[model samples]
Target: MRNIMYAAVGLMMTTATAMAAGTPYHEGSATIIEPTDERNPLAEVVSGIDFRKSMIREMQEDEFSNPGMIVVDYGAEIWEQVDGTAGKSLSDVWESCAGMDAATAAVSYPRYHDGAGKVISLEQQINYCRETAMGAEPYKWEKADMLGMTAFIRYQGNGEAINVSIDGPAAATYERGKELYYQRVGQLDMSCAHCHEDNYGNYIRADMLSQGHINGFPTYRVKWNGVGSTHRRFRGCNGNIRATKLAYGHEDYVALELYLAWRGNGLTVETPAVRQ
Candidate 1:
């Protein structure tokens, strides 16, 4: 009887979620206009302030209490572990090749890499450094160790601003990303701008929408109960809109990442950012 009851409850919950997703956003609910103040443009649109009221926010504030720190700790171990034909640790290679510590390295990511002849994200750079320095095989994109190492590195630059360059070789990619941001698709005929730019600070059902910045990527979402990449979140957003999801590390997504990083130029990096 208990097993039957549990199955029925799960079915009901799934049905409720499906029903909620199918409900359209009311026109009146999204009418809240964004503030025009240039000095504090994001002040009103960002959702962190409201999120801080929750118990999950408290966990994020306290390093000892946050579960995501476990992954960060594991990543530190990976950093020190020797690997590849060169038999150098990630830390050794990063110091020798990049001439910067992991903490500061993340701040300069999603930038053009002359050797690769394209823009690269922090995750890609880490893998590249691994391969070039040690001749080690790169970790898959969604691997826990990869996520952990990314979180560990990004945590070092917690308060630094996102400073992705949109100049020279990166310029064309940035333009393409901008076009994708405004291009409407899917059966719903919506673009990123329709929800994030047009209706930021407005209510979508019970949740308030924000400008959807990527500064807090590799974030620890309460919904996922795990750390996820910006690409993962991007794919989630696409799925929510009924759009065909792109593969992780797709060039288009990389371009989009560069654009979003530039869009959030001044925002502080909030790796392992706690979110619902």
Candidate 2:
């Protein structure tokens, strides 16, 4: 019932955006990049950009035109700004952590941490670093500081292939996420698979259903009018299904993020992607 209403509203809004922008409601697949890795369940893992209008794709390609860059810029400023009792910034912590480059580290998120002894998403990692290494207060979930920093970090991984491991210590968490993906809840009684897995590429009113990949997360949506974290997007989907919204940085959502990252193992990172 509510799901149907949300679908209708989304359809109308998508149509309106297309009409106002003078672009057609649907775009071609010229921008779609096929996955090089073979672990993907689908024959070809496509980025959200592939499903978006050309105008939106162009916005994502050009840093200046992409609205999400504003958040990235803010994050860049915060990266070097001295803070906390330790007087260290994110840059300092990264420099000390095994000398790994930020771009290489970005795609390996939602990873299992021995210290935390559980799966932690990138946002959780940021907070962990701040609280422990920088002796600074952690940013609240979905807040400007968190979102901006997340986008900035993920942006560094642009064009890098996503390759999160679900084996070993993270296997159990991955299985839980798989269960949640297939589990039906809310009044609509639809699971994530109902739309993303079974009906991708099909039209739900004016909008085309996508494979529900998160590789381009911290994405900017015209509807949102600002950048948002992947968890924030999860909350939106849960709302669209009339489900009880989970708090940001929930363990369950983190597990789901792990599962989705694994599912998109071969897809290229396109952080701060613009979507209609």
Candidate 3:
């Protein structure tokens, strides 16, 4: 029965990939989703929330009902508290580095880091500050503090459009990410395009598939019973396909985050989003 199930899945993957032929980005080795200026109607980018059930959407819309708010509130507290050998808090450094507020700094992420000499995700930036400026231990990935912190930052950018850069040095990373999205992985032989790109709005068992946009991170998930980061969600997707999961903040995952963020282009930030 398991073998039959795997076969069926393989067939689905092949069919999905074939059906997506001639489509941009996911179709061939070409990486550009579309020009930065012009929008593609065929690849209409929509927030994942649009595909969510109304109840989930309602939960995301209302802060009182949104369980992720609790995490964001916790993060706000963390932002103010001082820590590390430098005797600084995220707030202390915010004024010096991240520009006026978290909200303004939130939309730009998976950016190229000169020191790191590679693209890094928002979560990594937080940790970089902790290690370099704060002189503190970095928070573990997907944990309460990490989730709360990212939720807080992302929430500040709420309603803003996602605007990550994949130009110059970041271009290689974006290309790698685009490849990862379409590359088949694991025992099921499925890629992100199989479920999100091709089968979005289609049902896989009880849950409906979405376009898999990452405009919302540190989102509250009913299945998780709490807010989680995009990398956490990526790990879950890999696991779902029986693929080998990488550690949190892995370079490939960071690159993939860039691709996903760019794919989301103008979608409004919906941090602490509710998903089932």
lDDT tens readout by residue for model 2, 1-276: 999999997997676545434233134433454655464556666666666667887999898999998998999999898889999898999645423467866788888877667888888888888888889999999889999888888889988988888889999999999889989988899999999888666667777777889998899999999988888889999998999989999989998999888888878888888998
For each candidate in turn, the TM-score is 0.80, 0.86, 0.84
Best candidate, TM-score = 2
lDDT of 3 by residue, 1-276 (tens): 999999999998776655444323343332223324353222666677776655887898898999989999999999888989999998788645543367866788888877557788878878887888788899888888788888888889998877888889999998999899889999999999998888775567766677888887888899998788888899999998899999898889998899888888777788988898
Off by over 4 Å in 3: 1-42, 98-101
- lDDT at 152 for candidate 3? 89
Alpha-carbon deviation at 77 in model 1, angstroms: 1.1
lDDT of 1 by residue, 198-276 (tens): 7654557766566777766688888998889989988998998889999999988998888777766766777767776
Name the regions of candidate 2 deviating beyond 4 angstroms. 1-39, 95-99
Q: Using lDDT, rank the candidates from best to worst.
A: 2, 3, 1
Model 3 pairs whose backbones collide: none
**Model 2: ten consecutive residues of lowest lDDT:** 21-30
How much does candidate 1 score in TM-score?
A: 0.80
lDDT (Cα, 0-100) at 49 in candidate 2: 67
lDDT of 3 at 3: 100
